[model samples]
Target: MMIHRLGTMLLLIGIGALPAQSQVAPLAPSDITNIPPDPALKNWSVRTVQIPMRDGVKLNTIVILPRGIKNAPIIFARTPYGAEKALTGAPSNDFRLALPTSYADLAAAGYIVVVQDVRGRYGSEGDYIINRPLVGPLNDTKVDHSTDAYDSIDWMVKNIAETNGKVGTIGVSYGGLTTLYSIVNPHPALRAAVPINPLVDGWMGDDWFHNGAYRQSFLDWVYRMSADKSSKYALQFDRQDVYESWLKAGSVSDMAKQLGVDTMPMFRKLVDHPAYDEFWQLQALDKRLGKEPLKVPTLHVHSLWDQEDIYGAPAAYAAMEPKDRGNDENYMIIGPWRHGQGMVADGSKLGAITFNGNSASWYRQKVLIPFFDRNLKGSADPGIAPVTAFETGANEWRRYDRWPMSCASGCPSRSKPIYLSSGGGLGWTSPTGAGGFSEYVSDPARPVTYRQRPILGTYNPLTTWGQWLVDDQRFAEARPDVVTFVSEVLTDEVRLAGQPIAKFFASTSGTDSDWVVKLIDVYPAEYAEAPEMGGYELAISMDILRGRYRESFSKPAPIPANQVLPYEIKLPNVSHRFLKGHRIMVQIQSSWFPLYDRNPQKFVPNIFTAQKSDYQKATQRIWTSARYPSRIELPVMP
Candidate 1:
């Protein structure tokens, strides 16, 4: 009976095993679809092709055309960033959905948009050089950004069947730099160009170094950009706080070594040229383009609070204004925004400050699109002003016949000096006392942070580096190393419309030092609207200058210790009003860490390679007496 029961169970198991054998036989390789069907675009068709350059290098170009549309003008953009990624994402019927926020208004207007990867980045062929210089002394190669842009545009007009043979270029930051390059020797088809927050200069104050201080925070970006051809690799930090990591790394050289970026060609170039040498001067766009006559109807867009390329647009505008004989070819727009904020973000607000309206949207719909239409499509004139600037405190847009109306070479603006007095007082009158000074001990070990602590990496998604320029300045108010001077509450609105110059009469105990000057707007202590802004210290224009470069930006010299000298620091441009009932404040400090590399008190041949021993505490003095009047020269608008 037991043997018969076992046989029945074995028979059932055999039946299950037969099914398993069939499964193991791999029945007909299941047909599973991996890719989804392409979306039927209603108004747009996309295609990518390799556009050959004059050098025979094929550049990856993405062309987006308005379906059923004919003879549309081409809006061309050349960028080191991926062209494919810029215009492609989840498939959609509405082409506007795939377009970047900056191009939304342009896309709705019906035009062929072309984006190409610059040489040696993403899918483009040829070597990638940082801010590739024009075909000149710095660039000995047969092809530079100028020639490549010309070649690409030449090919674009001839090959693109739907294009009207008229092209306009637009881009931000490095893209902006390339846009400016395209117009150097513009193609016949190139008509209009817009360069927003472009990198016009590096050694003077755009990207790499500001004045003589190295922007060490950009090293991470350098590493990521130069790491791979596709720019896919990101630099990973072991510590969560970039400030801590960078501080621990000591010198810029040490930081580069620790981050394994010391071997990068850009890094090596930075280390090799610590001064404003010919290498940097040769690549300065403002200097190069300024000398040439305006060939394209170019509109330069500047941001009042641009953190990355603050010195670019204004500098370039000043350089090119001489050539704009009719004040028609060269135009400028300065808005209240961070770097490239007007391009991709709603400019209504930056950090906690609100501008009350969508400044960016207004710029696009009202100014940008119309400008392009008139230039590319031969539409009616937009009648835009030569200069359109957004006034911050007033929260209003103001049009001017010319920018910096107060202080340009031919403008009517006059620079008036506001003196710093003893006992933390600041006023328009010069100091009367013969001898008075404010003293502080500047320590490299505990340098004043540029912003709130735990600063994130420059390129981190959640990083506050973009908005740090607009952050409240109260964080550095109570620090011992920082000296504060305040003016009485304003009875009337004080409007400044141009660059503010910091002329310091100071001395340092150490051979070398750094000076940071901030012009701040202090709100009333109590406020009904936006209570959080009460007593807020908003920096209007601020910058740092290494003492070594006080005499000349290109040269470095040790200070005559304990002897007061005149230090003239040129702060970035500003268009702001110190409203009635508010106060003006000026904070002076010796260091702005992580943002700028620390300046060792003891003079070293190169601050990048300064040793731990070179770093030292120094006694700094700001003399504000009649003999040594430390004052800020403001282009006060009447």
Candidate 2:
């Protein structure tokens, strides 16, 4: 039977021969699709059930089984996003629905596809918590995502009609979080898992916070989640200008008040615990996984330019991969795409950079399919490497036995600092004479925008904000508050892999400040194949550090005014090759604008409580002398 038989019902209702259900609205004409379901819904069976959890909460689940297949290996996905969206192609009110990339492919191969809303989400019972903490020592009373997944799989193997008991879990982003959780203490039926761009640590890096700097874009998320919306999609502001609205709010505390904090318990918890207290520590995946070996063959997917969750994939792999070192059970794929771009078929070009071919399609057909076929179906191994990564500038895929690839071919095993010099030069040699430092005044009132003007909602796909990573940095060029240092055109191709560390010997005139270091690749001025590529300042890797959290995240202390301090900012790992004639550039600024909340300059107990008076202009200096040689350490590949 058709899941939605609205066509005939609509015809009958139009002629007044039948009555419509009060709660059910007919499908919109625009939603009618000639695109048939994979394996054809006509040849499959759809079942929606509330699977009982250990704690008695029933998770809303949808199971699609191919009609003629018996004992089909199950491909399961759990998300906070509604299961109905994943089932019938219904629209979700939640954040953009999890990418439905290779779902059809799996279903077409006679796999039983399962999608579920985790406990406390839509159509489920229990109090919803973001990044639910693990319940150490599993018991009947203790219920977490891991236990829930174990229970769900146990119940499915016995209750479902399918004979083949093998199961695999895969998800992207938050869904990826659940996928990761399932692997910690997995069920016997769980054979494989793929977590793409998962948010690994709550305190250090990911969507919520970077270093100690809180990501301001998530305020939009908090607002939407607080409301009684159908799904956790981004809240649409009444006003067209979100940037101006945030500017007027003054502080995060004030913004909460404007959003009616009484209704938002999560927002309250977020600001109340500004530091990395027990709240965030309990949620860090790395700390929870602590030396525990992975339970299954895992495939980790990542993108170097991922706007969010840039630190999760690599961090999680490093934490759990040691257990599988001898067996080659843990694998990773790093691509030159944006957040979750590896899921879809559009990895050809992002902003001005092009990958030359459909990378996502290739990954789906060759990498993903082969992995699942071998692991879940007892087929021969595809001979995948431990790490398959795409080098950006060189734009080629390379396989390695280990990540942070061992320097077998004379590639530098360690990083060496390239010193910053006066006259806007960057080189391996340190500066000698006077004028050895660069100075700029950072004013919170006139903070720099992270992207070009008219910055729209990030969750919405129609906006230009998604391509900010690959955007040319010339937009901020010549700004009084922004400082730029460049290296001479490379004589030969300079390839860099692994982490880029920014070491700054600097002093701020104020008590508190924020330091943003962006490692950039400058296209030659004469290059003009693409207008956006001409003199493009593509950011390869960047990081921001709030000076107050320099020592410890839990105990933040202000710097002594005008006292120089050594700050080491570890940027996310990257794989890129700066071709000959391309200049290596470094851009230093105090604010990343709406991307990160502006630092008040003056020290406050809590930044959320900081008043407008706390915001001040501060003169920031980057010293490049022999005594204080400020530099960035690049992991060069020979």
Q: Give RMSD to native, each candidate.
A: 3.4, 8.9
Report lDDT (CA) for all predictions.
0.88, 0.81
Per-residue lDDT tens digits for candidate 1, residues 204-256, read: 88888888989998888898789998778888887878878877889999988
Off by over 4 Å in 1: 1-30, 34-41, 88-90, 406-411
- In model 1, pairs of residues that clash are 406-413
TM-score against truth, every candidate: 0.94, 0.89
Query: Where is the poorest 10-residue window by lDDT in model 1?
Result: 405-414
Best by lDDT: 1
